[model samples]
Structures are given as C-alpha cells and as structure tokens.
Target: ANRLLKALFLVKYVDTFKATPRNLTVLVYDRFGLDLTGLGKQVQEALNLLEAQSYVQRNGNVYEYLTNEEQEIEKEIKAVDVDSAEVSSKLFRYLSSDILKTNKLKYAKNGQDFSFGYKLDDVPQGNQRELTIHFITPETSYSDSEIAAQSMGRDELRVFLGRDKRLLADLRLLLKTERYTKQRTNSGATPSMQAILQSKQVLNADREKELIERLRQAVGKAQLIINAAEIPSSSQDAVTRVSDGFQELVSRTHTNLGLLGGKVYPEQQVAGAVQSETGLFDAATLSALNSPGTEMESWIITQTGLGEKVTIKKIVDRFETKPYGWDLGSIEVVLGWLVGNGKVALSVDSNPVVRTEVTDLIRNTGKHPHVVVAPQKAYDHAKVAAFKKFCTDFFDEGAVPSDPTELARFGKDKLAARRDELNALVSSSRYPFVSQLAGVVALLDEVVGKQVDWYLTDFNKADELLEAKEDLIDPIKSFLNGQQAKIFDETQALLNTNAGNLGYLPTGSADTVKALLADANAFRGNKMNQLKTAADTLRGQIDDIVTDKRAEVTAAIDDRRAEILGSTYYANATPAAQESAIRRIDSILARLGGETQAALILQTGATFEQDDYPELLSRLVEAQQGGDDDAPPPKPMVSVKSISVPDASGVLESQADVDTYLAKYRAALVATLNDGKRITL
Candidate 1:
C-alpha cells in the first residue's frame, strides 16, 4: 500500500512538471490527485509507512493537518488559485490604517511585523455562555494605567468599527501595509471625495479629535468655575471687581479648578478646590424623615467608635485630628451624644424625632432667616414713637388734634425744633412709631368698611372715620325710596310724551350686562363667610389652645431662619424651595443679598453656592414654574420618583465568538500551504 501511494504521488508530481516548467519540490508538483482512497485507512497506513521509512516523510503525527511546515507550500498554492488578489489589500488597509489606528505602529517604510494596529476590541469572538461571554485575550496584559486607557480606547474603537471579524482581519493587514497608527486615524492629503467616503474615518477623525479636546476643555472650564470659584450672579447687576479684574480672576480660577472640576461624583477628579483633609469623622443624629424604630442604631455605632458610652468628645476628637478640622455644631454634638447613649441601651428611641437622621438640616437648625419683620420688642418701640408723632402731626406739642389756629400760633422756631426732633427719632428709634401708625390705620380701615351699619350713624355723619349709627340707615333708605318713586314718575311722564326709540329704550342696554348680572343671585350662593368662620373656629381655636404665641412664632421663625442660614440656593433645595420663594423674597429682604451667592447664603450662616451642596430638598414644580428673576420665592413641595425592579437587565453577553477560534482558523489556513501543492476540500 505504501509503494502504490508513493507511485501515485510520483505520477501526479510528473504531471505538474509537464504542465509548467519550474524549479520545484515533489510536494509542490503532487498538489493535486494526491489523496488516498479512504482517509482513515489509507492516510493511517501512509502515516505509518512514512514514520517507518523516516526518509523525508510526507505526513506528520496523529491529528489532522492543523499545522506543519511541510504542508505550508500547499496552502500558498491554494490561496492564490482560489481568490482575487486586490480585495485582500483593500480590506487589509481598512482593518489596519482606518479601523484600528494602533498606538504602537510608526513608519510606512517598516515591514509587516513592525507595522500594526489591531485594537483589542477588534479581536474576533469564540466561546459563548449565558451571562458569561468568553474571549481569548493576549497572554500578557498591559500595565494597569495603560490597561485603563487602552480599555477606553478599545471601547471607542469597537464603536467605530462595526465589530466584525472579517473586516478587522482585513484592517490588520491595511495597518501593516500603511505603517500608520497614532493620533492620525486617517491621514492622507484628503483622499478624493470618493476616496474620502471609503476612508470617511480618516476624514472624520480630525473633527472627532477637535470635538474631544473641546469637550475636555469644557469639563475643565466648568470644574474651574465650579471649584475654588465665585459666581458673580448679582442682584442689580452690581459688581465688585478685584485688582485682577473679575474676568481675570475667573480665568485664573478656570486655570486652577474649572477645567478640572467635574460632578460631585465626577468620573475623573482633580487635586483641586479649597483643599481639605481626606480623613473625616462620621457621626449620627435623629431625623424627621425616618419613622419610629425604622432606622438602625448599628449605622451610628459603626460610624462612632464602638464602645460603652461613646461620648460626644470622642467624635469631636476624631474630626479634630485632621488639619482644618470641621467643627461639629453644639446641636450636632448633643444629638450625637443622645444617640450614642441610646445605642448603649437595648431599645431604640421610638420618637419620630429620635429616628437616626441622614440629613444635614437636623444637625443645623436654629439659624434665622433675615426678614423685614422685626422682633416684637422693636415693633412695640416703633409703635410708641408713632403715637406721639401722629398726635403731634395733627396738633401742637401740647398734643391736641383740634384748634388748628392755636396749633399754628406756636412759634415757627419751636415747630421746626419739634419737627426735627421727632423726625430724627422716627427712623433711628423705629419703635413707638411704625406699629402704632399701622394700628391707627387699621382701625380707620375697619370703620370705613362698616359704612352700611347705622348703629353709630351720628359718628359716621359727623366724620367718615367713625362707625355708622342705626337710625341713619332708616332715613337713608326712606329717602332713597322716595327719590326712586319720584324719578320713575317723571320718567313715565316723559316716555308717554315722546316715545323716542321705544324698542331701544324698553329696558337696560347690553353695556350694563356685567353690572346687571353681578349680584342677581347672591341669595342662592353658599355664605363664604360661614365656611371661613367654621374653619377659623377650628384652626384658630387649635392655635389658641397652644397658648404660647412666643413659642409658636419663635419656632416658626427659628425653623425658617435656620433653614435660610444654611441654604446653598442651588435650584434644587428646601426653605425658600422654589425660584419664586428665594429670590423675590429673600434677596430683596437680605442685607447682604448682593454680596452673597448660593441661595441659602442670603439666610444666615451660609455663603456661596457649593457645587457639592448637601442641603435637604423638596421640589416645588408649580411655584417654580412662573418665577421671574426678581419675583417672589415659591413654596416647595417634597416629591420623588423611583423605579423598583427585582433585577436590572444588562448585556449578559455580546453573543460573541472570541479570539481563539479566529486565530485557530487563520493558523489552519496558513498551515495548509506546502511546497506549492494544493489540497482540494
């Protein structure tokens, strides 16, 4: 069997020589008509005989011809005979130079091995499993930093190239031929408009780079302005420029922190901003947000040093260890101490207020919001001063409202002196003045509103400022009835005489439509005052039962003011939660509104807006909707949106066939070459 196979192979080899003259080996000529009868029996026998002879054997080992130098000549013959040559170069170029511009490749003059660009992302796929995509990567991994950058680059590369193996393999060849891979993804003297389409990547890369650099700069600038920065957003457009000029300082800030600044949770952080130590001490306190027994004491114990009596001092000490340590406010310390004590006990404080709080507001309450409403003491003082001035305005220093001649008789020198004296204190001592003036005016308004009441007719008739009398209403109604009767009598007489434009004069004109219809059915309406009286009787009675005006007002003002004190004024916040509530009211009323930034800065303790502001917030969509720059602040409504899913869906796998299969395929194809001989599949 070995001799017959050898003879047949020799016959085929002679045919190849007869067909074309060339210096060739036996394997090259015997490329065709070389297969034995049955692959199992004949190939096995040939392999055994070749092994026994050991004289330039034709076959190797037990496995299929996946690889062997002896067979390489045949693969080369098969590849050329079967395919178009030019398509390979075009596809290869696209894969290498255009699709995956490698970092390592350099010169076009270099050979194939030196030329490169085959992004890891461009590698072909192999194995598959549910929730686990499998791929064969290079045996050696890159440095951690390089790996990170390359990962990003590879991710982007995969996006650019349509993750296809055949395309990338062709691209790898192109990259080798062009010897180009670097910043220039596609570099040519602008290929023909048609060529550019073929290499749109080369054309588009320039734009992409510019765009990327601009994006980086934008993020950098935002960071700079946001960090170590001051926004000159002012009321009245007032500016206090520094020596460097506002723009110059801003540019400096941008250089320092802007371009580097990112989200509070930024992807890449800069070693910038008003510097502070990383070591921070954690503490816990009660919160309004949590329900009774809903919160865990374990969180607090973990944060605070676990011990029997975790004292307030221990927590403070931890924070103080860092340079520029943040001072825990008294209330915070107290709350922390309370919780520490509570933690030591078995039962949790079930009070709504004592639940472990995760918010900042609970720790910093008590600060006041600035407002025009002065303390009651100041109000009373202003009232007292106002009474004397009111009296003096209508009279002489003797305090009389009547006898204007007697008042005029007072000397001009005395009057000027008295006026000057009163005016001087009216503002300085806003006391005994503003309130009393308002009180008198309110009383006047009350009397004017009851004009129809005739219980005090004499007073009303004598002076409009007084209440009406009872008999006055009867006389007025009678007189009005008589006048109405007389006018109708006269009108009937005139109508009978002339009858001018009878149809038009039949009744009232359309112009009186609104007035005619206005109280036509007033008796049918529900008495609005009845509902108000009922409501006020309940709520006001409830308020009255609380018998502590000072406590009520103090608590309200204290809570609001405290909230204001620490406000960052970022669009999303609480207190003056909406644009309407904060700017229109707070800014106008704030003493340092112009100097401050960050919405809450206008309150008290806070200053400028911190990009990473952590103030508790509630939303106010309706109130914020119509707010103008100078409009009053809107009320906030606490709202939230959430999605609950048992599990999040993700790309468990790209359904990818990984690199190992592709490399094996390529190697198998390459190995099939053998001395110019071909193997028909």
Candidate 2:
C-alpha cells in the first residue's frame, strides 16, 4: 500500500513540476486513468500519505507540488503494485470528498463522465499571465464552458480530447508496467519518472511565424498611435521626432511588460523599418550630418588665418546660404557638437566659454559667440613648450609648465615676479634710475599684471601676446642689465675730473663725490637717464666747490704778500733788505702757482701770522752792509779816533747826570773837531 501511494504521488509530482497549479481530478485522470472509480478511496489515502511526507500541499481538491529534491522521493518509492485497485479507490475518494466540501464547486463535461472543478488556492495573484492560444479549428469565439471557466478568475480553456479512452488507459498501464519491470530488474529501485514525463514545448516553424506576425501587428498599432499625435510627416526633422517618439513608446512598453516577468521583445526591427523608410538611421546619414563640424573647424582655421573674426551668426549665415543650406537650428546643433567635442572653440566678448557655459551660449542665439579652431593636442603641447622656453630665455628659468592651465599659471607667476622686481627697483632710494622706468612698469601692469583674464582664456593668442610682451620689455631689461655699473662709472669719472681740478686742497675735499660714486655702485634700478642726470649735477657741484677752494687759496696768498710788503719792519729796512724781502715774497707767490699750491698754502697760511719778519729784516740788512769777507773796510771822511765821555764822579750816577756829562763832552769835542772831525760811538 505504501509503494502504491508513493507511485501515485510521484506521478502527480511529475505533472506539476513546473509549478503549474492543478486540482486532484486533472492530476489523477490525466496521468493515471479516469476509469479508476473504484480506486477513489485508495487515491485519497495515497494523497494523504504524500501530504504527510511534506511532498505536496492539498487545498481542498487542489494540490501543489512542494518538494524540490525529486531524487529523495524516487529513493523512497522503491516499488509499486501495478494492479492495486484498492489504493486507487482510496485516492479517488479523498479527492472527491475535498471537492464536495467547497461551497462554489462546479463540474465540467469530460466525454461521458463529469470532471470535478474547484478553485486553485495557490494560484498567483496581482499581475495576470498573458497567453495566446492557437486553435486547430476556425472558431471565431469561445464556448459557454470556456467563458464560464475564464469567469472563475482562472485562465482556463476547454478543449476536446481526441484520443480514445482505451488507448489512454493502455498508455497508463504501459507506464505502470514499465515502472514495475524497471523496479524488479533493478532490485526494487524505481526508475526516474521525471525523465519520462518531463517534456519541452517547442514551437515549430509555423507557430514561430505566426507569433512573429502577431508581434508585428502589435508594433504597428503602437506606431499608428504615435503617428496620430499630429507630428510632422516629412523631412529629416520629422523623422527625428518620430524616431524619438517611437523609442519612448518602446521603452514604456518594455517597462510595463517586464513587470509580469515576460521577456522583452526586440523593437529594433520595427525601429529599423521606420528609419529605413526615411534613410535617417544609416551610418552614412549620421556621418554626413556630423561632417559639417569638421568643415566648420577648417573654415574657422582659414578665417583665423585671414584675420577675420568668425562669429556664430556668420557661421549660420554662411551655411544657410551656400550649397549646404542648413537651417539655423541645425547649424546651431552642429556648432554645439563641434564645441562640445573640442573641435572648435567658442567665446563671447573675447572670453572663452567653459563647458557648463557652452549650452547657454549656443541656445541664446543673441550672444553671437566667436568661434576659433580648438588647439590640437600636439599644438597645445608645442605651445606650452614654446612658452616655457620663452620664460626661461627672457624671464625665469624655472618656469616650465606641463599643460595649458599650468602654462597660463606659470606665465602669470613669472610676469608677477618681474613686476615685483621692477617695483622694488623703482621704490628703492639707493638707485637713481627709478624715475626713468615709469613707462616700462606701466606697460607691464597693463599687459600682464592687470590683464589676468587674458592669460587665463586666450590660449590661441598666447604666442602672439608673449612676443609682444618681449618686445616691450627688451629695452628695460637691457637698461637694467649693467645699469649699476654704468652709473658707477659715470659717477667715478665725474669725481675724478673734479678732484683733479681741485688741485689737492685737503684730504676730505672729494668726500661728496665719493659718496655719490658709492650710491651709484650700490644702485639697483633701471632709470639710466635719471642716474646720469644726477651724475652730471654732482659733477657740476664738484666743479663749483673746486673753484671756490682755488679762489680762496689764491686770495689768502695775495693777502699774505700785501701784509709783508706794508709792514713797518720792511719799510725801515735798508734798500738791500727791502729788495731781499721783495724777492722772498715773489718766490712765495711763484710757489703758490704750483699744482699742490692750495694744500701748500693751507699749510703755509697756518704759520703765516707767526713769521719773525723783524728778525729776518735785521739779517738781510747786516748781510747787505758787511759785503764780501775778502773786501777792505771803507775809510771814514773825518778819520776821528775813539772819544769817551764819563760821569762827573767817574761813575754813571743817574741817567740825567750821564746825559749832562755826555753833552759837555760832545760840545768840547765838537769845538775841538770843528775842522770836520767824524764822531763814532
């Protein structure tokens, strides 16, 4: 009895292996035999046994196969009784009793017997399954029973079974007999029933063709609904709109059908058909439409060469009028594509548009952005290299950069650095050249320091601007190169010329000139002309100082000569003494005319007031009267001998007594010598 129940459960399990819900009536009649009325109790017992084993679930007369491991069930069902009417009757009674318990139960015609019907408790809910059934006969509508079954909320169809009952019964018997023979031959091991019952439903060529035709009709209906929406019906513009609408519909349909776990139908066939009718979906057409972007780039490059500005309005007008008469919208689209792909550049008011700004510029139409050929990768690389080289050659050597952005950054940094350098030079007091570099610094501020946006956006004109900048800066750089040395040389030369003219006045006479030279040597500016002017002014000052010093020295010498000649000592001196004094003064005057006379006179004048002119006069008079040592003394005219006068007491009592005695003696002597006698004391 256990073996018989197991075999019945195995047959039911195989029939519903696909998870298709089925009731006990169909499960048993379809696989086993409908003539087993007497075995209804046995079938009921077998079902109860299978349910106890957890292999299937019974909801009224409906059964759902639950076990996934069919091998375990095969192992359990070792053998079965081929002629067990008692077991079959038990199963039949169990199914019939459950069906009779349901309140809304009904019956269906099955040849001469009635098939029990019941609701499938385990049927899926929510989304319903869609099925397309093909009938062999040309029936236009469903029968009453079919409609009634469908109304019960089950996707059920009624069909006639054409095979004879005997053949069905024999087929069941043959399966059972085969199972029994396999169990016996293999030592009571049942063969796998799934291998015999599991069959695949394959659609033959005719059915496949019919399914394709049905899909075509459905897609046609979708396209018809899209067409009826009043969209344009000709031209590429119309085709583009239709294609967009078709794609949207296809996407929505796929999403809706995908909810039921249905495979998405490929819509490419219908889409391709629509595209083919208008010749808009081919590769050639897409290439042709995009081809203008390349041409536009070429045109921009050509226009740039001709020094003509290429604006969006100009581009549109050119294409709209030529053999390629594209509309404004189409031209805008192509231009946008060109800019987006980096094939060309767009700018408004001399400023390039960023990626996020491109759309607004293209759509606004009134913006009239200028277009230029986008810098190629190779060209950009070369530009960066050239910019770096220029910076190294003319500015700083460490200013190499790798890309356009870095190139711009490095350029600005270098320019700023140079500006700062020049500013420092201009602000420094040590350098005398500050005032001469005003124009150069102003130029740098205008072209580089203040125009930051130019460096950031004007990549196409980088080389040109750099060249212009170089030209403007060349003179400043040249002037600054050896400027300090030049100023120092000029200052030194001025000092030397003035110092030579001063004629050795004093140790510190050239101090001011030395200071000016020091300033020139230490100068760090680019104002060449200002420094030169300062040098000239210093030279003139030195000339004035030297002239004053020379005149002062000469006047002091002349005053000293005048003082010597007007002195009473010189006046009372003998002729020879006076003559000698005159000669000595003349010699001093002659020495004053010497190259170092100013310094010598300064030294001489310091002792000029302390000169012993009276002593000098005495020596000059003695030498003049003494004559030569070998010469004889001149004879006196009177030839008088020595005469002496004494005081009254033969001693000098008082000056008055001495004077009286000398007078008496002098009178006596005079009287005595009245005949021309000469007196000597």
* Top candidate (TM-score): 2
**Model 1 clash number:** 66
Q: Report the lDDT tens digits of candidate 2 across residue range 176-278.
A: 4345445545564334443322210111222233333332232222211221132222323322322333333333222322221222112232222122323
Candidate 1, lDDT over the whole model = 0.29
- Tens digits of per-residue lDDT for model 1, 1-681: 344344434554353432111121232344466543333355445544543433222211211221233233223222332232343434333333443233222111111111112322234322211111011122224332333344331211111111223232333323332232222234433334323233334423443344333322322222111122233322221111111122332233223112112111111111110001121222211222122112223334554344343333444343322221222342233333233332222111321121222122223233111111100111133333343343354333564322121112232223344334433433353122122223333433433332211111211222322221122222222323554324323433433432332222225322232221222221122422333333334333333323332243334434554554454433334335554445533443344323212222223222212110122232333323345778644433221111112232443344343344445444544444332222221
TM-score to true structure, per model: 0.13, 0.24
Off by over 4 Å in 1: 1-163, 170-178, 181-288, 291-297, 303-681
What TM-score number comes out for model 2? 0.24
Candidate 2 stretches greater than 4 Å from native: 1-417, 448-681
lDDT for every model?
0.29, 0.45
